[model samples]
Target: MSTIEQPRPATSPSADWWRQAVVYQIYPRSFADLDGNGIGDLRGVTSRVPYLRELGVDAVWLSPFYPSALADGGYDVDDYRDVDPRIGTLADFDEMTAALHAAGIRVIVDIVPNHSSDRHAFFRAALAAPAGSPERDRYIFRDGLGENGELPPADWTAAFGGPAWEPVGDGQWYLHTFAREQPDFNWDHPDVREEFLTTLRFWSDRGVDGFRVDVAHLLLKDLPETLPSRAELAAMDRTSGTHPLEDRDEVQDVYATWREVFDSYDPPRIAVAEAWVATPERRARYAAPTSLGQAFNFDLLTADFDAGQFRRIVTENLAQSAAAGSSSTWVLSNHDVTRHATRYGLPPLAGREGKQGVEWMLAGAPADGVDRELGARRARAATLFLLGLPGSTYLYQGEELGLPEVGDLPGDRRQDPAYHRSLDQGTWTYDGLGRDGCRVPLPWRASGASLGFGEGAEPQPPHLPQPDWFAEYAVEVEDGDPDSSLTLYREALRLRRELQAAETLEWVETGSEDVLRFRRPNGWEVVTNFGGEPAELPAGRVVLASRRLDGTLPGATTVWLAP
Candidate 1:
């Protein structure tokens, strides 16, 4: 690798960089329109690094900028070494890395190890080769033709929809947990492992600080197919008939393989795994000290509305994570899911409680399909929940502005295959809608026209106009407003970093559903009231608030008190 001895920028200790450190997830297409193509490009992201630095994040996790067919929104890599032309060229990526490094902000790219697009050259070569060839072993291919070659050897459901197995040009079958366009790679193959490591070195040599590995748990599945019995399948409520629980014990070897590769790089890098399994145990396992540096715990994202629910989720994760690994990650929203605002809002109630029942009553509501006012409260409340936690926190792009889910459409309206296959043919109920709502264009500068995110020079008439509510809530607009959401976030970040507020903190339920108390050994307390009822809070010092509470906690008040 060639060397470019740019002045070494000072970075915080690797161990402590995560604390009080914010990470912004950039969904390339919606971030900015660089070529008038309506899609965000690498240069667009490079141009926005200054904006990210201003947001107080130490690093930015750019969602897959690699060569892809876009079958899975860039998750399906066709060539791991190259950058996609749709987003930008390799030169653009170099520029991005240099700029981010110069600004003291690290860059973390996504490496999808579990699968690859069907059009990938390796898979194509395997397809043309005869059965039992060395190349054919690189992927999982089955030749059993019991059910007209359409049925797979086992009864596994594809994550995108339908069966997980599909027939290629020949008489053989290939396994894909997502769209048929994506073929699952056999990690058991030595060549497969080498390819991933080389890919890591390719970008690491290009100055990528680290990686946010995609679907880390799915990289290795149960071997010898363990299908549940007919009666057991009927008794269960989940879509796990063909799950790989049988081979769960041996899956860590796959993670260990990646860890070995990351260890080879200088200055030691970080890896954040996306453990998408149902159980917290599996998620915790991926974050084991010997495994990846961090694995996101979605339990925080799936908590109930009350303080008790939040407490239980936090307590459970912290306990499990402490036992399994020293650290874990917390996330409220991401590209494939609904915005927090839409997920936590209560529906319109005709009862006497009115909108007051929104948070508590609708705690389980999916983030994508909620009403407006309830969405805002839920979004802001979620921010408080995320920042006050003990572990590292991840903020999806546009989360700070409290962006809500975009409305669903019928027919070609929906782009996410996951939503289309499972619920209402593409439309999701409050529970089933997975990620369609959060995938819309970001509301950046409120030109009042789709928040300035359209593809062409002229904005589309039907474009979801930028959330006007953000005019007062954006970074630029809120720099002066001491009471704005943007300001609250900035202050919370500053407190978390400067005062070490979230470190070594213990959450104590103050005997009130409306009030949440966070106590630290340093004689500090953080209280937040999600309810309409006011509660007496002990006096110390006010650290931050969504709205200034008049004497006590009123409805929907969040106060950070230090004693």
Candidate 2:
């Protein structure tokens, strides 16, 4: 409890700092390990303060570290106010928070408001209580359909794939949009709504800068006895549409209340909603000034490497965000998705919708159709382009190292609920491929028994296997390589801050629609070549380039030039 690293005093509001901040996401379990258990812990995060400060990020968004049964990768939060014992203690969190603040980096912890682990005290009590008990009122529980109550209450399917309803015996069932282990909360309940507000104040008081509201749009108004049909659900009604179970109008009130709680604090604990809504316009509501203040724009995350696609994604996102008076965000890879390096490297289909279907992702990323080198190159160029944009940037942990998805993960050892719950008529579908590949523990050293994660000498294997090739992207290996992706990112981030006194973007026509060329209000421009042959760079002094410049910008390359 030394004063030197204790939480700093709150300051005046940060005046919309999130609009242009660079937020790095740290998937706690995969970030770094402290206990010899091979899983990352809070103390481990405290140990990385210098590295985070060195990266020049404004804040770190720590993914769920709440107590859980590892169902749905800790999104099945059992407790809102405390850290899991396996990860570390509440004292560890406070220390980590203080340590991060001491480095001038803020903290944004994940808050899974939509659901709770079935093992949670309330959920367990609800299961044991009678059908109409107040305990059952805290969760969505209903009687089954068939005569013997053998059928689920509705035909609704879980996001991961199986039926959304889980049997609780006694002819009753509970609703879980994700896995059965994660039972959705009854947002209609006063206790549920008030409890989250308390949770928010608890963390804000603990010195967290913000909350990354998980599944921010999935909370419900109230669950009716009958549910909407699949066709009705598919018709998004111009994207502002709310589904019967998922999105509803009342959820807006939930966010408004949370916003009030957030702003009540000095410096105002800000929030970014992880709302996967139907349209960009819908997503913007979560970022409305009176709401979470920011919402993640994920269009780029699922987009192909084609230049045209990136332009359209950014343009559309910007328009939607502006129309709603909210700033846009850009992200490439995260713990939940297949890493961008792998996505961009795969061979494109002749006329298919996406680069490829979920098949390649589910099939261990077979080498037959992948070009790792090509993918890494696009990923590097893409980051440069994003840094040149006019809004906030979110960087997934291993992206700076150009880590490819470890798609060859053995199925037997996988822990993502998507793999185990995606059962449709007893056949495993493409959706069954969970996000284990991208969530593997990060490598800190080029050679170590635990990649210098935590365990010394002898250690338990990481929850997910790390491919031997991870060494190439390990901190020890890339720290010394001038041309490494790690170096490129550090330099790009530094220059981004210097170049982004800009609030507006001006398109620098490069003749070809296939080349992305845009200049910020400052005299710096970012040109990325995606088409065949070389795209000429605009006349300016070179600041940085994803690849060595040989007079012209080569395809899959990007460069920033200063006036």
Give the per-residue lDDT digits (tens) of candidate 1, residues 1-563: 11223333456447446544578888887776556455677887887766665566678888987787776778888999888897799999999888887777888899888888887888988988997787888888876456555555666667766777787746678888788888888877888988988888888889887888887767665455444443553465323324552225456776676677777766667788887766776567777767786777777565545666767777787787778755657788888665677655644232324234333323432323345666676567668757767767888887776666654433355556675565534523333444545766665554555554544676453212233453443445545567666666766766765455544667675777667787766766667776767778667788776676688775566666655
lDDT of 2 by residue, 107-150 (tens): 89999998999988889899889999999999988889899788
The C-alpha TM-scores of every prediction are 0.86, 0.94
In TM-score terms, candidate 2 sits at 0.94
In every candidate, how many clashes are there? 8, 0
Error of 1 at 177 (Å): 0.8
lDDT at 384, model 1: 71
RMSD of 1: 5.9
- Give candidate 1's whole-model lDDT: 0.67
What candidate 2 gets wrong by more than 4 Å, as runs, is 1-13, 235-242, 349-366, 423-432
